[model samples]
Target chain A: MTRKAFITESDVRALAADLIAAGTRVVAPGRVGTPLGERIEYRVANKVDEILLGQDEPARSLKDFFLPPTDVILAWQEKKDQVELTPVSSTFAPQVIIGAKPCDAAALEIVDKVMDWDYHDELWFGRRAATTIITLACEGGDRSCFCTAVGLEPSGTRGSDVLLTPAAGGYSAEILTDKGEKLVAAHAVRFGADKGADEARAFAEKGRKRVDANLGLKPAEVRKWLAGHFDDAFWKSIALACHGCGACASVCPTCHCFDIVDECEGLGCGVRRRNWDTCQTAKFTMHGSGHNPRADQSSRMRQRVMHKFCIYPERFGEILCTGCGRCARVCPGGMDILEVVSKVNEMACGGAK
Target chain B: MAETKILAFVCNWCSYGGADNAGGMRLKYPADVRLVRVMCSGRIDPVFIIKAFERGADGVIVSGCHPGDCHYTAGNYHARRRFAVFRELMIFMGIDPRRVTFSWVSASEGGKWRDVVSETVERVRALGPFEGYRGLTGRQHG
Candidate 1:
């Protein structure tokens, strides 16, 4: 357990139960019944039977738990002569996430740059410090996922504490961090001796090849192209079909724009909250005079791409996306990110217009 | 002092002067319109209008010089084109078109400014308070 080891499929399940029984939150990708069919989503799993071993990517990333869609930031009360306000605290309980996709895991680390840029986001890092991530090698991404292109492989352990690859009995577990080593040590009975040094190499190789076929682009080249094309006609044509819905932001792991609102509940008291918002809408940049910088869908679309590729990279020295492909999958309009990136890369390389 | 808070952005050369003329002539209009004067209507960014609405505006107005009479030559024309696109986006986002009003006023048109403010107040009163962006003021959930 101190080094590389082998965990049987049933042993992994037992490990999940052990974590839950010890009052630690155990989260994993599980099947939820939707109108169409079963959708895999990361949910709190209590028992071994609840965890979905290897399935499709979750409908959303782990960002939902860390950042949350909406949360209260502060509460206030007004008196005759004075106003009182109280701020929210950033503290979380220890938890374990099993079966996380590598792209999703890497997203956490990529976003960590922005969350800690100027203001150290207390809530974001609070959850990060308290949770241990165990990523499952991905093999299910279609043509939309591009984790490898953004310096992450399907089996990459960029943000994971432990990396689990499917092997003969269950998973070939590679202990990644101190937390991962501790996790294996705590459940040493579940993980057996390693079969070999490269026990899980074959499994990771196949998974990597599967996602590699999706799409690839040079992140630096795309950033360079975006830097020069702020007013390009391509932005207009590329987003022509977009209905300006912010669904892409809702699914994006790295798209972390939020609106802070103060809500008066009733009778001299209120709460200030932050909710997820996106630049895809005109309201995002609207001024008090009814003037909008990103006044049209075209400009808003360009902002989204520029933030992910150029602006974020130039400012934070890192691209703001993990290439999880959820945005393309959930787009109601035919707005495909792969097409957008490919076009930018093509333009950079002096290829097709 | 009015219960209905209306955010009005006025161009310094035209709409602002028109509003000043109305005040000088003692022309009565709804006091609900809180005015913020910009050197030119073209200086207005749609985000300012959005921030006004989000910050608890019942209604908003963007008044500037008439099409050809902009003191900045063609500043109002640029604003006109910008609003044309911004209005379409607002409608697509499910915001009521009536909640936001746009008009062109000249420096000599004090009577017109009075009428526009009164009519806009009435129209917005009929529509009632806009709580779509209530989260901004700590009033209610959006």
Candidate 2:
């Protein structure tokens, strides 16, 4: 498709500032720690440099910015004639997320399916609708990134309003939808006409190579292997060292299992909350009558693999994993899911009948 | 021998009916399995499974409709996916995955219900007792 060099670095910052001035809240990755090696922190966009665009993915995910760790859903108060169901305070302001990678935006789209499937999650959807995401294409992907493995490319514009590709000291910004058009129109002075389209394509190709190298196996093949190997011994072997810390699932960009709880505060006053839960935790599938269905690590390991590969695809026709490699990085026991899937596939192909 | 306590989380539509069918048939299976009926297999939260273990149940079974026969069309599909992952988590925690069993039992399958209970009881009996991971406040027995 045709592309345009919308804004330079200086112009991008000016556009962000203009958006903020025009009553649109801007959120971007802010720098934390010292100059030697800095960490990224999600904060409101004010300064241009604070918005880390075209860098590697952040250590933390964009999930926290939308679905917070903990929040009150509903408040209840008892009355003489009727019981009042007071909704929690929703202070969602319309905002623009600058410098979001395409992979992260795609992950949000994947999560939205489950969250909005059976139940309408107002809290998550509220934040999503109120924000316009502008994804900056990765000039170079990191060693841990494998967004391409799960039907996404580093430069793919699957779930972004505006997709910005790096060009000659500027960005070849493609207006993806009405949202992108509106965002650009809001700060028309910063945007320029088409300039370096070929350079952006070259950068995207380099980024795609890095992404493909990280993914050793195809997602479709992994799903097929998992479908048949529900009773494999590989699950027992790899999951033996698992401490069930649930760090992998918590840090994963796609793991969206949650539990809703009601907290009572004396005379019928209470708050309902939805907290993130993980299948990697031992207590995840425990029953009320004192029976734990998945009481051991081996079975738990099997469940984790099957859920991602077999069951999720059966239901949603999509693999639950984004291949971001966060689970492999964060897992305390060095439980690499890629290695596990590969081994399982090998066993299946070898006619282990 | 101490009584084997089995906790069964049955889906309201199929598995629960199967269990009820077992009762109607007067098919004598082990009385060890206690049934807790839920709206659907999808409603069987992971917390409920953990709480059952904490409360001292020796075994837990999550029974629902067959893959394609779910009353809600795909509730069992979601449940299967959930338990698949939950099983992995349990295995990592030094827990025996055999203690938890997930099976498909439709409403008409009274015979299957008996078989499930029989198999689960036998398996739990082989595993002996679950005294390993007790709750924080629960009494620990040697």
Candidate 3:
């Protein structure tokens, strides 16, 4: 049977301390100060007070826990004119993520389709298997958010092992997957039978309404319009001020493009590493022979939109974006993706020929 | 093509030799061009030209030997077909086709090489520097 329980704010903290005491790494949304000032980041938490759960989405997504920004795949050594490659281990240690945003969690399930499409990414799945994600119903996003338009709500539990909704004194813990059940059972005293129904119900409603107030686009129409208009002049105007700094990609929940390079430390040894990359930049498609297919920012911008709205859905049966709105908030050029989608919606209506 | 910065992709056996001949004969070519030699014109991927423009090149030229005269027979033919599609696509995306010029110069035609370079330089100079995608870095003005 599925397990449902009530975890008070103090109970959640105790659970975190208990997990850490048992030598399991606990990850949560915590405040981090950057040059841009204080923003929440998904980081390791040593104490419960450090965590800021059920707030606005973290500046970064949960993808980093599964597919890190940079990872070493293999190492090589040239000994006596014979080169040998040593493979890196795919297995990782146990960890638990607390207070995940719904959009961030859903992005994992969406990207999982591609990561496992052609070839199984062993490292990606390895971390996934080793980690259990506990997601909190979101704190609500701003005008830039459009999660409801993409068929997701603030309470989405698509990828979380455990779903937590704020209640009277704490949260209503809905044990979702097998890992979540085992966790609650192993630490049975940390949770009590579900008794926070009224507060949790009201809180979930408020979150849903907050996100629903944002813009909604018909994904099917957006995809159809994008499929036929690769040469549209609308694309030229959409990216007029695009800085191509790729800050949007850097914060995107599902933008998972990466580049592999061989870094040599010395004449005898070297390592092959993969680093996150973005199509927003020209180097993403540049050829060593001095040619680039997606040459300018306009062309690159078109690819970004196409991949999210058309190519990915056609290939994977799902839209690429989760409507987290972090891209709009982070863009230096003021390129708002929601505004572009609104234009695409107007064009789809057959008025902008 | 631009008087400010013009880039050229020349085929090793022919266009490069044509440029060499012009220099050997003391022909005066425009000083705007910088040449990168590949084994054959077919080796020039469209990305090279895109990279050039992304780096602020105002004009670019891809020169090779006459189609049937390529050292590696049929290489220039492939480049011709590729550029035909790419050129139109660039125009559709608002990049002026005149900014990117394609020509065939034989090794014996040193004068033709000089003329192509001079003409490309003059045309691209008139059009001015490309600012279409410079906002991407925002540092282009710096």
Q: What is the TM-score of chain A alone in each candidate?
A: 0.95, 0.90, 0.96
> Tens digits of per-residue lDDT for model 1 on A1-353?
33677888888889999999999999999989989998889998977788998858899988987887887778899988788987776777888999999888888988999899889998889889888998888864788888777777888888898888877767888888899988888999998887634647776777677766776678888888889879888988988888889999999999999999876654578788788999998899899999988889999999999999899989988778888889999999978888888789888876554
lDDT of 3 by residue, A195-298 (tens): 77677677777877887787767788989999999998988998889988898888899999999988664357767887799999888899999799988888
DockQ of 3: 0.01
Interface RMSD (Å), each candidate? 8.0, 16.8, 15.6
Error in Å for residue A98 of model 2: 1.0
Give me the displacement of residue A340 in model 3, in angstroms. 0.9
- Counting clashing residue pairs in each candidate, in order, gives 26, 27, 6
lDDT of each: 0.85, 0.79, 0.85
Q: Candidate 2 lDDT, tens digit per residue, A128-212?
A: 8888888888754666666776778888887788888888888888888777787787778888987777888898898888887
Name the candidate that leads on DockQ. 1
Q: After superposition, how far is residue A59 of candidate 3 from its true place, in Å?
A: 1.2
lDDT of 1 by residue, B1-142 (tens): 2368889999999999999999999999888989999999999999988878766788889999999998889999999999999999999998887888899988889999998888889988988888757554433211
Better of 2 and 3 by TM-score: 3
lDDT of 2: 0.79
Relative to the unseen true structure, what is the C-alpha lDDT of residue B50 in candidate 3, on a scale of 0 to 100?
86
Q: Write the per-residue lDDT of candidate 2 for residues B37-136, one digit (tens) a residue.
A: 9989999998888878876788999999999999999999998999999999999987898988899999989899999999999999988878665433
Accuracy of chain B in candidate 1 (TM-score): 0.91
Candidate 3 residue-wise lDDT, B1-142, digit = tens: 3356788999998889999999999999789998999989999999989888866677889999897898888999999999999999999988789988899988878899999999999998898877664334322100
lDDT of 1 at A325: 88
